[model samples]
Target chain A: MDFLGDYTLRIVALGAGTLGIVAGALGAFAVLRRQSLLGDAISHAALPGVVLAFVLTGTKAPLGLLLGAAFAGWAATLAVMAIARMSRIKYDAALGIVLSVFFGIGLLLLTDVQKQPDATQAGLDRFLFGQAAGLLRSDVITMMALGLPVLVALALLWKEFKLLAFDPGFGASLGLPMRALDVVLTGLLVVAIVVGLQTVGVVLMSAMVVAPAAAARQWTDRLGTMVVLSAGFGALAGVVGAVISSRVERMPAGPTIVLCVTVLVLVSLFLAPRRGLLWARVRARRARARLRVQAVLEALLDLDARHGDGHAHSEAVLEVAGAGRGGAGRTLAELERRGWAERRGDDAWLLTPAGRAEAEERYGGRR
Target chain B: MTGVQLEIQAIAAVTAAACALPGAFLVLRRLSLLSDAIGHSILLGIVLAFLVVQELTSPFLVVGAALVGLLTVVAVELVRGTGLVREDAAIGLVFPALFSLGVVLVARYTDSVHLDTDAVLLGELAFTPFDRLVAGGWDLGPRALWVMSVILAVNLVALLLFYKELKLTTFDPALALALGLAPGLVHYGLMTLVSVTAVGAFTAVGAILVVALMIVPPATAYLLTDRLGVLLGASVGIGVASAIGGYWLAHALDASIAGSMAATAGALFALAFLFAPGRGLVAAARRRARQRWEFPQTMLAIHLLNHEGLPEAAVENRIDHLDAHLGWEPAFAREVVERAQRRGLVRSDGAALELTDRGRAGARSSLARTA
Candidate 1:
């Protein structure tokens, strides 16, 4: 509570938190639409717009710069679409093209602005990898003002957006103007991305967009729950990132925030129910153990069937039935442990009647 | 351009060509973004190599970058194999993590080291000539020029030697597997070339230009031709053009050389997108327009032919009736008929339109084509 009492800390946390929610909500749509990297592309493309806006208006205001960024983001999306559609270059390549080229232009302009004697181009370079410490009260207010509308739009068009993400063809069939809805959604995504750029930066902003939604996806199946969870996770990462970077010497907040969200995503990937890697691994181990026990039981049943009078089978025979070398010993031991079979000496085993019945049932009584 | 400028341009061209060779295959395989990932992640390798060898000019730099570049691909594939994330997301996840690690390493070691993050992200081709390679106490021209030349040669030789294998694996990996070409090995080979080229180009043009040169040239070439050989040649040509053009542009603007090169490459791509002969935007648009114009004229002739002596022949054969009958605007209908008439496919007989013998023959062929 005392930590939160610091005014500057509170502002940075709020600003980062607001950014995370907006980016994460929009990122869910981007991720679902398989345009996860659109955030990256749009952010990079927004660089030139930011500089251009400053030059044109000569204003250091956040709103004006973000508006310029939105325009550039929209243009980049269009360029990517055009390149993908008009040429053989795929969407990913088109994305790369716009990203590097626009960023290059931005760099060139920044350098030019810096070399000029009269222009005070300080802090413009922060857009590369954002410095959250630079966030002002006005900037935070601007972000909230810009962000709330994007959130409201996303909420208002939740059903339509869901249809667009999950089943655009179905939405179109229902006379929903799916294409126009897509444009609006993309526009909203641009707005969300532009607002986050000053905090997370062009290089790492996409991670903010992708990681929260990705983590949320691990914990939920329903879209509404996922979207809500994603926003929360994103905000958590942002605040945590802001706190950590503030405490640590010489650590930039944007990448720190990105890494925080990435850690969340990795944790979710490993520990979430059903889809988690830990559960999958556990299930696999159980499945293998079950198969081995069944194999040993079947081998015993086969020996009993061949002898017709309850003869003990040697361990070598079990090995020959596909349990190679050491597997035969372990399989037999497991069977004995279950009272499914009994060892003759140390090298042989015979199935109990119960084991025979169970084996027959398992194999559909084929034997 | 001055001598120094010429040398810088030459270095840029060589770097671009080397990158473009592997880039062509990358574009074809739809693994274009993976190149970007590799370019970014190779910084880790360079930093590790520097830490180990304690020298910036060692051959191990290239080796280290190649190893990490390969690791980046392997790591991405491993993540993708888990079935959690798609290929693109996996790439996005892996590279940023490695890049951030590299950035932190550079930051931590900056006091004792000369590693400049700015140069890595944005290169300085303008200063390449000053960093001359001295071998056996003899000046061996710019270090960047020699390194890039060696890499360019290596790339060209590899592409030439494995041309068939590369082509087979890229266009149809399953067939390459059937033929025992070992496409996985070829894929690794191509990746190694990309890594080597990226590292070689790093000192001259930096990561941004490396990504640009690696992708844009081949993408532009894709728009220009369908043949792989022509595609390769066109990409190399475009790469050299962008390199030189970017050099002059940077000189004129007095900006960052690498940024200018990337921007130039982008401009070249834009031009190819609009104006490439077969598959460009302008070409596609023109083809669509021609089709639109010709289709209506053919329909008009066919309509006249269908009503040659029928009851509606009187109405349908009238040129003005075309607007109402076909639901076309009056001006558009008039234009179609005039075009047909100019081509000797139609004749007007005072308020009535009729098809000539040539028009009838044309209509029969159109019907045959449809049938």
Candidate 2:
């Protein structure tokens, strides 16, 4: 409770919240455009940029470093696109190439920086896995400055961005510069990614981009609503994760935030209304139940039609219909409960008038 | 290089080449991201297995890590199968979460000394030679070389055993399925091999850059060749070359060796992208440049041959009329005529153009090509 009113906690929370909102919103487009892995490649590519900025500038300004990260990430994505377009390399392979290669070069450079005789570079590798506790008020403001423009750009070109995400080919056909738009959109993504990199690090930053949007996608089909919900999920998870990590020693906020959002993803994946796993299972069960009931009713109707005057069948109906599994008796019971079948004797069954009509309609279609 | 240095390079080269074998198939199948996903997430497997075995050198740890690699693939497929997310999104969702769990576990439960998380991401290939595989107190070799040598052998055996199935499933999954080759089974098998290779290569390249070895060389090979056999062989060759080249680059710079190898592979890919003979960007651009002049000159020769001594021969064959009749930009037409004349394909007589004997032969051949 002592940490509740702490000012530093609030600032870190705000920084993480800003990260979530920007990354989540941009990530919605990335996921929809099937460029979810692009975020991973971009983040990995940002490492060299962050290190290079420090090596060149002899200063570690968050804004300048993020700009370098954005530039490097954007350039890497362009390389990925070029590799995919120019050669027989698949887009995924191209992405892997850039991701690994850029990170490798970054590592190579990071070590080179560390070896400098006058180098007092203490925490440059912190960007690799973020040093979240190092978040300053300026860092928070830097995130806002970087993130807010992307949001404003998103607002200004809502229709074009939507077209860019959903149907770039159609947008291009409509005389839009779809390729240029894609480049700009990717630039925006790189900015959003660098905004989060300070809080989430390179590897986990991609999870920040992808997880919230993926979770939100399970809850909505509309783009605007999905983006809003994704932002909410990201921000909620970010604050909670930052606070939890601050409370627990040795717990970094980036992975905590990643795991927290992962929990939301799993919850959404399994429990969201229309698209969730639970609903799918329920729908499957309902369909299976309906099929079994129909089969039993048809069996009863077939007996009536063959024996004349609603002739009855015994418990053998369940056997004949092959419904004798988990709900073997329940299928017949369900029919009787629906007043579609009735008990003729202790062990016999007969089709009701409603059941006969129901069976006839379905059975007629089959015939 | 001393014996130790040579051993290090041998391990690096073997690891690189072994990874390349599966790398070739992964690239061909267009599921190269699986390598990235598996590489990161297998850290959890190694860590969890290490907790149980308590011995870093235990073979069960390798098996456990490989199994976790398979689990990562299974988890991605399961998530993607739900239709809630696409494959890439599923990949993005699954690996980081699992990897983060691994990081958290390592951070919380384990000491940093044994399983340093930094070593997991950027492995210390420099220290790999120190961990010798001693038998009866005799130094057999570096443990990494033995691990990677077995993996290279496994990959080679797998490649030879399932080359047909892999090729069939890669280029034509529908036919592979119809032929009852069980492309799905082959896919899982390929994934298993990938997971195993990632585990074997994990100690040398670390979790992140194993993807570099597993994906980059084959991807570079893909640019150089179109045939699967050639692609696989080229991947191995390129991967080994990167390993050897990277060892020296690191030697020169005092940087991370694994990182250097990945960087070297990346540089190789960049080279192949620009200059691979048939399919490279430079090659294609050069081809276009050659055709720019060559194609139009052939057309000019054909045009001249068509109107030799005819009533419209002067009008049609005149260099001045080329812009209007042939729809050239006047400048382009003059350039074309000049190029043709320079090549002895046509001669200019006053304002009329005449085909030379060589020009007639060239025009006839052009016509024959069209036929």
Candidate 3:
């Protein structure tokens, strides 16, 4: 109870939850555009910007670091685009190249910064991987302030984004500024990523962007529903991770948050009603069972049709049906229970009127 | 060694080798971002290896990293199989979580770990040789070169052994499956190789440079050739060239070596995109312009052939038709006619312009080819 009552825990949870909503909203489109990796690339790329900003300003202020991150993220995006457009290299490869180069530069810059004699540089390392435990009230407020407008903007452009995602060519043909929309969407992703980095860090921020959207996609097909659900899932993971980490003496916030997101993704993969693995398996099983029952009924009908009014023995029918004597007896019992068959004498069974009608209807009125 | 001269050679070789092998597969598979994912996810492998061995220089580190890289592929595949998340989204979901886990572990266990999340995520290719591998008192500073060589060998052998299978599967996976080839096995095998290559290169070159190595060379090669075999060889060549070039550039500027390598690769790709024959931007533009110039002349010939009703007589009026299409500019039309005649497709018959049988055939063939 005391753990829950802690002000720091409450603040972290609130901040993470807000960031999650923003990330979830942006991630839905990022996933749809197949630019999920872009999130990872940009987040990692932002490191150099953070270090550079610190070098220039000589301060580890949130605003300066964020501005630096945004610049780096945008620059990485541009580099990716330039590589893709200028070379025969595909978009993914370009993204890979840009992500690696930018991040490497950032790492080198940070190493240089760390060598400097500054106490503020002491905790700057946390931003590299993320240390959500160190999040302050001002940080939380900053996240919410930045996150809310981005989420609201996404909401406003939800329909446009959906159309753009589903078919950009058609969207362009219909006079939509697909390029503008793309920029807007990419901008939103960058903002969400930069802000989320505070909570999840560069290494894991990509997961936060992708996991909730992926989980929500399992439960719904509609874009609006997916976005809403994804946001909900993200917030839930955020709150849960924050709470759990706060309870533990030494657990950091970022990994716990990511773990929570991972759990949600796994659950969605296995248990979602319409598209989950378990549901698909159950559907397949039911389909197979129905096919077996139908096959048995078809065989019985064929036997009746062949024998006409002569009433062939059940043993002969079982042989024709490719069932063993024991198997035949079990099928007979099942048919009798369903009122589809009746024992006529010592070794024969007859199809009832309803059974005959069912067989005929099911097998295209076959004998 | 002078920093500039030494750094250039080191960066160039590492960058070139890194990009060449993976870039080919990335282009073929169309999962270019897989490189990005592998780059980030390998951090987890490194961290995990560090934890188990408690030493950064353990041979087990490479193995552990390779295992983690393979784990990332499995995780991505598993996520993809869910069908809820698309392929890129699945990649996005898996690598970050693993990377985060790596970061958290590092933070918890290590004291002010210099290999931070960004460093792990991006790589340290520029400073790679600074960390030397001393085996039996031998000085092997460029450890990445050896690791990459082995990985490259594996990649080349696998590609050669399964050339036909890989080509068929890459061009048309469903068709390959229908023909009784298990695409799943090939896919898993390729992914495993990618993982091993990525992890092996990570320590020597750094993460981001590995990406540059994996993607840029193949892309440049793609621009220069249409044949798959040639493309692979060329990509590797381009990668190596860029690595060497970028290393030198970085040393010259005192900049990040990995960044310089990537920039070099990017510049190579840009050059190829602009100047390569057939598919190059300049070539394509030239082709388009030539097509526009010849179109009206071809159209005029077709019109004259339709009007004259005699294939032989059509040759005499070919220039007149060309003139008519351009509003009867005699000098230009005559030039066009002479050019067409020189190609053995037109003939002069006194004042009337006409086409030869060969000319008619040539016109038809050109039209068909364009269409």
Candidate 4:
């Protein structure tokens, strides 16, 4: 109720929501291409572009800054590719080189800007970690204008992108222009990152790009579903993180938004119905229990075949049916608890008639 | 340079060299970007350590920060073990979350007054000369110099002591493990040193420069040489040079010293990328050009040999018909003929071309190699 009534909450929500949708949709491709860290590289590389734009234009207009950032981000990607292709240096190392160097240049320009006796550099630091409370309607409008095209492009080339992300070799076989598609996709990623930088900042913008997509992936296998779900999760994190940070004292919106998406990712990892850690653990436990029960029952049947049902079987002898000593011991104890087998002496078990029938029914064909 | 300027340069140089040492291994391992992760996450480590010790200059802070840095690596590894997400995604997921937590901690508790966030992100190397380390009232120069010197010593000592193990593990971890080198221990040990170096340098260079210093120089050196020993030496040399060069650039522009240092490192890497004699872009292009000329000549020689004294030779050997016969552009066919003629690999008579004995021999050798 409080969030609904608040005007700042609404603005933060709209701005962060737009950012989330754009970032989440683009991030799916990045994550799929194993370029998940590209977001981090591009965002860091953008700092120089932002600073250069300010110095070149003599103004900190978002449009000029965004253009500069896009250029720098694109150059960084190209540099990374060039370094990887031209030398033995791997892509990851190239990424590091580009990220740090570009950021370093940016820092130099930024500090130089601070040396001048001016007020323009006042909010420049906000680009590092972002200050969502400062977002104006114009910034939000600019984000929508930029974000809409990215989404439109993504829609226009959905099949090509899917093919490129999943199987570029096959896409090439299909006579698809993969290189052009790659450039266009990376271009979209650059745009998404630039738009979000003002709100989430450079340091935390990568999380907006990666976390939502990562979370969405855990929930589905279909690319289309993953994209839609990622966009939804991103929007949800955006609105929730923005609203909470706006209400809380000393809570920065950028980090808060990142943390909110992280929470979603963790929840999906551990608690989602079928793919979750909890479910996997439960399934594994059930499988183990089934195996142990089968082994004990089979061992009991072996004893019946040799010396009749009442004959006690040694723990070591029963282990031949399957599993370790501790496992067989536990299986025997479990059988007795279920009234499937009766303990005859120390370290021994005898199968009940009912247990013999059950084992026969389940593992009869296997033997 | 002035005395203060010299001190600043010394600090920056030592810091870069220290980062470059462990960075070589990271680049080789293809985990160079992990240094960036460690660099940012270490801020959280520093802030948490500061909260506990309540002293900015406490040794416990370094230990706490180093431990937290190690924790970042371990956390990344743990997430990677899930097999659901990729290594880069895991790295992307872990560092930002940890870094954001650190940011939130700094923002909420300190109000950013006690610990200037700007200094942490873009370190004030120019101010390094002011933070003098005094022991018992005796001035010990700049604190950054002392701290970075200690880190450098640690890096050098560790590198010297574990040279063989590090080499084996880096080049072939499975072989190192077979020889009882404990590759896992070496990996964690190297990670610890990386974190220690990064944390120590954080005060002088900030997170961005520290990451740049760690990765860029090593990568540049990798482009120049293939020898491990030379890589190490060149990386350290490049790191120091970038530091000095960056300082001067900052002086000329009157900008952030740490930032200029990072830019210098990037510039040096770009230079190596384009100009390194053995593995540079230009050299590679030249090599490609040579292969292109030689390959077409070989194909022409082979074609001539295949159709020698045959009726098809009259039509196939002609320069105009070769384009359609071999699917080459007409200009390319003429260029190939001209090149082959210059090399004496082929004789162009009026309207026909024939491979010489030398051309046939060259074709045979090349074809043998391919086969």
Best by DockQ: 2
Which candidate number would show the highest TM-score if scored against the true structure? 2
lDDT tens digits by residue: candidate 3, A1-367: 6754688888889988987898988888888788888898898789888889889988877878887898899888877876677555677777766676676567557655665666456445666667677888888888887788898888788778888899989989999999999888898889898887877787778888989998998999898899999899999999999988888755678888998998999899889997999999999978865665576677777777787883745646665676443356666677778997777887687778877777788994553
| lDDT tens per residue, model 1, B1-371 | 57787788889888888888999888889888887788878888888888888787789978998799889999988878888877777877777777767766765665434777667777788788999889799997898898889988998999899999999999999999999999999988898888888888888877756878988899989988899999999999999998888878878999877888889999999998889887788899999998989999999989999999899898879988987889989888889988999999999998799899999999989999999
Poorest stretch of ten by lDDT in candidate 1 chain B: B104-113
Query: B1-371 in candidate 4: lDDT tens per residue?
Result: 68998998899889989999999999999889889888888888889989987888898878887888899999999988877789999999999999889888998887476787777777888888998889999998998898999999999999999999999999999999999999989989999999999899888889867889999999999988889999999999999999999999999999888889999998898888888996888888898989988888888998888887999899888888787879989888999999999998999888698888898898888878989
- At residue B101, what lDDT does model 2 achieve? 92
Candidate 2 per-residue lDDT, tens place, A197-251, comes to: 9888888999999999999999999999999999999999999999999889888
TM-score of each: 0.93, 0.94, 0.80, 0.91
Which pairs of residues collide in model 4?
A: none
Report lDDT (Cα) of residue A14, candidate 3: 91
**Residue by residue across A57-150, what tens digits does model 1's lDDT show?**
8876888888988998999999998889878899988988898888888777777777878777765666766768889899999999999999
For all the predictions, what are the DockQ values? Answer: 0.60, 0.82, 0.40, 0.80
Give the proportion of true interface contacts each model preserves, from 0 to 1.
Answer: 0.50, 0.87, 0.60, 0.90
The whole-model C-alpha lDDT of candidate 2 against the native structure comes to: 0.89
Per-residue lDDT of model 3, residues B1-371, tens digit only: 68535743754575466457656877767877777677767888888888888887777877888788878888888777766677888887787678767766876776545456555545666566576558999986566656666677788788889988888888899999999889889887877777788777665456656776787678778878878988888887887787777667766766666666676776777677788888888898899888865765675566555556665544435555555455758886776676766767666776566667877876777768888
| Per-candidate local distance difference test | 0.85, 0.89, 0.76, 0.89
Model 1 spans > 4 angstroms off: A1-7, A322-326, A364-367, B303-333, B347-357
